[model samples]
Target: MGSAVLDIGGNTGALVVVTGPEWSGREIEISTKDQDPLARTRAAVRARHTGAGTRYTAVFPTLPAGPYVIWRTATEPAGTVVVAGASVTEIEWWQLP
Candidate 1:
């Protein structure tokens, strides 16, 4: 999962999904104080993934909150790779059923 820091004044969020060979589906969940566009997007991603039975979550820092994005990719021959920018907080990998 990958998360990006958002602009404090910004009010939009986005979620991304990438399906892989072993991945059947994904579930993502987000919690926020308000129903901002970004927050809603995060929630939607969570709902979709939850409905599919996958588990995912990405959280950003304060001030801007976040413009977080999450993705799932098929296991690569070289294994998984994660790249983060300066605004990123954490990145994780999981083996799916």
Candidate 2:
């Protein structure tokens, strides 16, 4: 499984998103003393799956600080649900069964 990273910067805070394989359509929010966006993104990705099935992995490093929504969309004609945020963090296309 391969991983990709995206960096986000805003008045709220810095954000990082990651994507790869074995990822479920899930979103995670982390609030900690540490303020490293990269670390946070990495931790978030690690918490998620590596890869599985047509569902590939994806990561969002940063998003507007506040309540947000993360949804899945088809990359192309294939039925792969791409986990996308308000802003694209990282996108990875995996092989289908």
Candidate 3:
């Protein structure tokens, strides 16, 4: 079962940051490529439980499809990803090497 809060469709998409308990209560930032580096959207990391187990994550429910940068800090970038319309983009931070 899923929820209806994610309104991804048309030229819009969604993003999910799959992190770990260590990142709980932290805010994760992201910005579309065309936006100023200083302008970013943020979401607080929360815990979600599924059949597998409980996991920490941040969900950006809706965003315009395009290249986006994941910020490590206000001035540092951790990585980048492309968001596709009508779908969800996920970043598994805990699994990063």
TM-score winner = 3
Clashing pairs in 1: 8-64, 12-38, 13-38, 20-74, 26-49, 27-49, 27-50, 28-46, 29-46
Task: List candidate 2 segments past 4 Å from native.
Answer: 10-57, 71-97
Descending-TM-score candidate ranking: 3, 2, 1
- Which lDDT values do the candidates have, in the order given? 0.34, 0.37, 0.86
Report the CA-based lDDT of candidate 2 relative to the real structure. 0.37
lDDT: which candidate is best? Answer: 3
- Residue-level lDDT tens digits of model 1 in 5-45: 45433443232333332433344333333334244222222
lDDT of 3 by residue, 1-97 (tens): 2232798999999999888799888999999888998889998888887898887888999999999999887888888888999999888975433
**Residue-level error in angstroms, candidate 2, position 72:** 7.7
In terms of lDDT, the poorest run of 10 residues in model 2 is 73-82
Residue range with the least summed lDDT across 10 consecutive positions in model 3: 1-10
Each model's total of backbone clashes: 9, 19, 0
TM-score of each: 0.23, 0.24, 0.90
